[model samples]
Target: MNEDSLQHPKLERQPMEPRALKSIILSTITIVCAVTACIPLFSVLIMLLYRGGKRLTFQLFYTLPPGAFDAPGVGGFGHAILGTAFMVGIAGLISVPFGILAAIYLAELGPHHKVSEIARFCAKTMTGLPSIIAGVFAYAMVVLLMGHYSAWAGGIALSLLMIPTVMLTAEEAIKMVPNPMREAAYGMGCTPTQSLIKIILPVAMPSIITGVVLAVARAAGETAPLLFTALFSESWLAPNNPTASLAVLIYNWSSSPYQNLIELAWAASLILVVLVFFLNIISRAVGGKTKL
Candidate 1:
């Protein structure tokens, strides 16, 4: 070979300008699409606040609707608010323990066993199941057992919706716990259960709380399940005795012919959004504190 050919090698090269331009264009397009999709939700929120904020008084929180269009506001939503809280609370109570335990059992005790596989499959299946189906299942199971729509029935439906999410999230959180910490605990004479409780759990608490907050937010907004299982109330004040939730009330009011009812529905939607937002903020704060 000639000296030039022996000393020099062909250098494969790429044009930096085209690649950079293509990446910039793709990023811009992606952002634009995301912003466009978010617009409808933002618009609805703005419209709600503008048109319904004036109607959202302290009285609206406390009173229920009157029988007549012109009748004085005869009732408050204290009952509905309480009902929503109770139903969601009961659902969380049912879901969190089962989910977290199942996740622990799967991760620590039986990673590849038949039972764990079945549990995983069931959780995945449940995650995609519709809220209405959960309601129907609750109605068929618990409501039939009780012979009526009750808050417990509603709770069962919400639990069905929540458990899958909790299980998946718990598993992921536990998995994220550093193996070194677990080994250290084990080296220090900690049992598997003790290590899980004291080390893994504390370290993974932020993720667990995030999962719980998301579950609560989802359960709060669910109307179809409550509609079929809990039913609705016009004047009922107790959740345990079958009462309406804010979601059900919003559904009823938004569909009513009266403009005032529609306005109330918008106001209720705004309140629900605000409550969910605050819950998310609190969840973040808790997560941050746990990290420290």
Candidate 2:
């Protein structure tokens, strides 16, 4: 046989089939559909940045809203900004410990146990529950009992929202820690709690931090729950006896008749987006480093 014919057998030189071409075409279509779904979110963000760009000034960060019928570029969201931070901080304080403990229980004790199974079910249910429902629950349980809306009430609501996120992320983080590490700690005469705190937790800190960051971001943007529980304020600053938050302010301004208030709303939104974006970036960087 000729060398050329021997080198390239008939089967080896076969052309690409129509079925393979169809599979490629279908995969391309699936990718296009996925990209198309993201367009609306991109468009909304673009519109917000464009409309709110002119009002994004230092004064917006420094001053409070002037009032109704005021011009586009007036007052800032300082009070709201401070309020959001305080509320979210309190929420984090409330959620993080519980979440970490729950995660540890799930990971260390094994999820196959009845208690772990129940905990997992509860977490899943809480995760799927509506934000408004959480708000209502807080209002009924905390606000009504307290006789009015308070920062504490808002913090509790945010904590409820945060717990599931933290728990799930923490569980995943704990699981990510290699089993050999735990075994090694045990081999060295470390107690279960000691191994968890000294070895597993330190190793999983990055993932836990990432989860906390994400939970904080979500809690920061929550409006519906804050509405029923936190309520809104124009005069009283958050961290006051009773707190007010950025989400409440945004909700109030966006629904107001005044263009100035609406503009302030947009500016507040820009601030929130920037804050959350930076948080996510930090979380990713830390997670990546720890992963390495």
Compare the candidates by TM-score and give the number of the best one: 2
Q: Clash pairs of candidate 1?
A: 62-76, 63-75, 63-76, 64-75, 64-76
In order, candidate lDDTs are 0.85, 0.85
Question: What is the Å distance of residue 96 in model 2 from its true position?
Answer: 0.2
Q: For model 1, state the Cα shift of residue 89 in Å.
A: 0.8
lDDT of 2: 0.85
Worst 10 residues of 1 by lDDT: 67-76
Candidate 1 structure lDDT: 0.85
Tens digit of lDDT per residue, candidate 2, span 12-60? 4223678777888899999999999999989988987997776889887
Off by over 4 Å in 2: 1-16, 236-242
lDDT of 1 by residue, 26-113 (tens): 9999999999999998998889899768677888777776554654333446667878888999999999999999888887789899
Q: Considering summed lDDT, which 10 consecutive residues are worst modelled in model 2?
A: 235-244
